[model samples]
Target: MSSRFVFSIMTLLMTLISTSSAQAITLRGEIQPDRYTYYLTDQYAQKLWAMNRDRNRTIRFNLPPGELVAQTDVSFAYQHPAPTAITCISSIYYNQGARANWLKVACIDNNGLEYSTHQKWPDTSIAKRVCKVGEASCDAFLTMSSDNWSGPQ
Candidate 1:
């Protein structure tokens, strides 16, 4: 039991398993655009004024591959009457070792109930990212919100 205390407990269990496998685990959540729904392409009726009764909002997300740092904050509100055109779009799909990449961002609403913030940095090779209500075919039930996205660190 004494070989220098078993080599200092095997070097402190291999430095706590390599510092907890090089620490970095963060994933978040918070999405509400009328509980998900997406399908639009009517060429945006009159620039999307609630697209005929909030055609169902949508957002999907998945990430696993490597390096990812993203942030998004979207807030929308509308009373619709040909103003308050909310458009929030975020799409990022990726693969690097075999070459594949797609990145898109559209957070529009230059006036009326607005709050849009989007960011992406440290993209070592993403894998998933999808948000909706762009091109406006629907999603105008307004009061939309978003926040869940940390990364595939």
Candidate 2:
């Protein structure tokens, strides 16, 4: 290959790498595993939701199927366990504990283990902005369904 062609290929490779990395969780996370379980916190989940919604402006994801829970355990997972999308985020309440801060969402279990539409998990900045809207929570009005990942309403 010509030197110029090689340089162009290298540049393209770098851009792709950086773009993919930008959407990654600031904390560590794994997208694939034979089996995995994620213990997400209220703050982190909300942040992910916010990022999901932003990326998919017209598309809305399905919330965890079923009724919301009174309270749930949140993990102090500084290194985000997985790229999660709430199974149910109809309403989020803070569940504080020595271990972690949880939400009141009693939805299905998904911890970025299995593949979904959002393979490239969004960064924490997006989720942070989402929680800012409601001070305490972000799923106040936001809603999702069990209809699976969507593409344009």
Candidate 3:
């Protein structure tokens, strides 16, 4: 084999090796109008990984140390009382006794999305979740059906 050809092959091999050894992780998660869950993976290239349900989709992600953010969608149906209130929550844990903060958006009776803060901290301090919102807890409003909530109507 020619010297130039041999050198090129070595360069390509080194590049591939470096890329594969990088420290990054992929994450997946799933969120319904009323529930959600997520998990992190081993770091791949200085990044953590997470995956969710439904989206059944995976994403390659990177975040600054001590910083985290997640986004997802949900669907819900109206009840007899109408103007139903829907509250959804999910939890996360890092170390055995690490503190983790959580933030989530809830979709209620198709009135649109509303954000809620973490009401109760889990026993582990690492896990974060939300409380339930019901008819009595939420104020009265118009109920939006699936069709009415979709597209230009």
Off by over 4 Å in 2: 24-78, 81-153
Model 3 stretches astray by more than 4 angstroms: 1-83, 93-109, 119-153
Name the best candidate (by lDDT): 1
Worst 10 residues of 1 by lDDT: 66-75
- Local accuracy of candidate 2 as per-residue lDDT tens digits, 1-153: 999999999999999977752322221232121111233566665644444334223333444432122121232222244344332222232324424332222233344211122212223332323232223333322223422557678
Candidate 3, residue 97: the lDDT equals 34
Scored against the true structure, residue 86 in model 1 reaches a CA lDDT of 38
Rank order (by lDDT, best first) = 1, 2, 3
For each of the candidates, the C-alpha root-mean-square deviation to the true structure, in angstroms, is 17.3, 17.0, 18.1
Comparing candidate 1 with candidate 2, which one achieves the higher lDDT? 1
* CA lDDT, candidate 2, residue 137: 38
Clash statistics: count for each candidate: 1, 7, 18
lDDT by residue for model 1 (24-61), tens: 22212333232211222333323344432343533434
For 15-77, candidate 3 gives per-residue lDDT tens digits of 998775232122123322333211112231012122112234333344333233222332211
The deviation in Å at residue 26 for candidate 3 is 16
Pairs of colliding residues, candidate 1: 37-57
